[model samples]
Target: MGATVVQLTESKKQIQHTHRTFDDQTKAFRSNPMPSISERRENLKRLKRLILTNQERLIEAIDRDFSCRSKDETLIAEVMPSIQCINYTLKHLDGWMKPSKRHVSMLFQPASNQVHYQPKGVVGIIVPWNYPLYLAVGPLVASLSAGNRSMIKMSEYTPHTSALFKEIIEGSFPGDLVSVITGEADVAADFSAQPFDHLLFTGSTSVGRLVMKAAAENLTPVTLELGGKSPAIVSPDVPMEDAAQRIAFGKAFNAGQTCVAPDYVLCPSDRVQAFVDEFRTRFSEMYPSIRDNDDYTAIINERQYARLQSYLDDARAKGAKIIEINPARENLGDGTRKIPLTLILNTTPDMKVMQDEIFGPLLPVVGYTNLDEAVHYINERPRPLALYFFGYDRGQQQYVVHQTHSGGMCINDALMHVAQDDLPFGGIGDSGMGHYHGKEGFLTFSHHRAIFTKQKFNSGQFVYPPHGTSLHKMIYKLFIR
Candidate 1:
């Protein structure tokens, strides 16, 4: 009973702290509502320096959190991309901040119209466990670039990394300008409920719905970066090795915990077996051993491991062909929580693996007779975060691009589009909404305030209050036609 009381008290304290931090940040934002571009650029530069100086420590923390996160994978997927995003934003911040000159209709001549990009005060960023560093820093870069004060809520699942990140950030920036909140699921719920200028969440679709509902209470605009069953379609004419190799890398990188990872493969009916064979070959080449291999990342935690294992069990029971590409054939049943790149063939829509977003090293192969069938199959379900089509045919590529809907796509490649700093990354429907990256990122966190300057003359006065006046009629007659 005493322990329970203590627990409740601690929970309440954390909730209060989250609220206080948010309030402080809000106050700070109001004081310095519009930070100069130089200030914003300095913030990004400091962030980059922090990441670079503590790169090894951050990697180690994530490794400890995951039990065995690949250092190379963390560097490539998290650190490198974060620095690159900051660099890209710094290079383009000036251009993005410039007021856009807009055309004024002749009806309102002698007036100048422009759109000023103003920061949306304080932004709330909720980072997911997978790729914690990059996910947190990527949105931070966008938020800082837009000159908004920010408060980040790091995932509890990644405690070590989250704690270290909070420490690092707190040491560099004032708490009111940039605060980091850390705690369990309840704390996250409380964090989401806080009133923010804009909230950006990166996580599963189910959790995203709750976040949106919470944000709605405050009428806070939200940018949800949710994950779905992003698919990879292999064309009949494409080389099996090429398609399989690329798909394998996408599905195997970070052990396929990526939000934009290729969840399933749509292959030509006749080439399914060949594609699987090549994928197995490519995966084996990538990591010949899984049990003791540092390059091979393990599932984040035992809970996630069990969830993924249950997926395989359900698929196997449903008469799906399970192919385990354990090249070394080592028994990974140990506590390493490492599962080799497993492929599920003969999948039915009724199976859990097919229904849910497989956010692990499990890839399901669905055979399609033609491109139309493949496109139709994708359209029937919720729009995915990403889509990969591998083929050299320009007409077929155009057809795929025109017909399908996804947050992003890659032609003749898989997962590489996300690495591009210029493209705007986001989803369409159930996958997600609102983009944040490059120019779009800056715009997402900014309010495009339309300004019209009229000195010594008000053109709108010509049509004001009095009806059917000679001047008003003349003006209407001249412009209406």
Candidate 2:
């Protein structure tokens, strides 16, 4: 089968029509999708139940899609994040939905001002393969919580999970309320062109640009979660053993395939060897055996595996030292599909791996003069999706946090910043646009309608008759001043 999932056919036309039903009912939905804050909260409750009840199937499908994803990992990382996000919304949705109180000028003292949250109408969600279930459904929950009907375009890289999700959602939701579109490549291009009120996409930077351009045709707002080379700077103040364990755990989990995983590390030049020694010990403790091991998941497909291998070979050719972190005697054959746990040292900026986001089990260790050099080197690159620092000093942590803008950050840890539902999750500059999760997600999928109520007495009647010198003087003195 082609990378595209849906083709032009009778079946595809039916699916397309079904997915377009939300746009069809735009007028009715815009009027009453959720008239009150309580209703939006109830919708969140329903979606949370759906996720908790079906988590087993989600786990199974993810495993089938990616050779050996850990059930616990999926639940902890993806499922729990979504659940926590729902609870966060449920806890705060009412207050968010409540109109904000604005001060009225003395001239219009009788009137009131506030902003109301309105559904963005039809929402389009495009997901990627790495964590198909979570990435797909997480945005869907936000759309639904905002009281918008949705259509989801699953990643072509993860066919099995997409098919399963299609069955479940189609079986549960009315086409007009919620739908799934499983289509071939052109269909995604076509879907992107449709008139959606808003769109949210989670994928690589190149595809994110394409999705944005397509949405631009309709002036549809979009929340794009794009990727970049995220960096981790280890302050020499941190304890070696603790820092190594945390960094090792993040880089190797899911084969270092996470979007926000630290792409490389910077430490003092003299401390590089000590850091490596501690990381080596941590890897053994984390995963004693990884070959054909159910605990370690493979790259989504052979094409990606080859891409990763190409990066490794390119770095090796460029005079970078490659460190093998694999257990003794492992198979790289079809059954296991295992590549050795790999690390790189003595790397330079020109190396191919350094230039790109290494979304694989390859970690690079580079030396720097100190925190200043590390921060400067990262600043020179595209702002990252995430930044990691391993230190306990409050001033250093605050300095890095305030000085650099990332989608998010983790102090003394790696990648777990995403799990905290209270904080916003997203990127900056080339990393991508907009944010979601908790209140951010609700706000992303909503349109805050600015409303100003006027009392029986017209507040602006004095200036309305026409533009006069006296009125201009009153407006200038009362309003401008």
**Clashing residue pair totals per candidate (backbone < 3 A):** 0, 4
**lDDT per residue (tens digit) for residues 292-389 in model 2:** 56777778888888888899899999998998877645656555556666889989788889988989989899898878888889888899999999
Per-residue alpha-carbon lDDT of model 1 for 1-481, expressed as tens digits? 9987886787788788888888888888889988999999999999999999999999999999999999999999999999999999999999999999999888888889999999999899999999899999999999999999999999999999999999999999998989898887888998898889999999999999999999999999999999999999999899889998989888999999999999999999999999988998999999999999999999999999999999999999999999999999999998999999999999999999999999999999999999999999999999999999999999999999999999999998888888899999888787889999889999999999999898897777878886888998888688777
lDDT score for residue 186 of model 2:
64
Cα lDDT over the full model 2: 0.82
TM-score (C-alpha) between model 2 and the true structure: 0.93
Off-target runs (Cα >4 Å) in candidate 1 are 1-7
TM-score of each: 0.98, 0.93
Question: What is each predicted model's overall lDDT from 0 to 1?
Answer: 0.93, 0.82
Residue 59 lDDT (model 2): 88
Model 2 spans > 4 angstroms off: 1-15, 22-39, 333-335, 464-475, 478-480
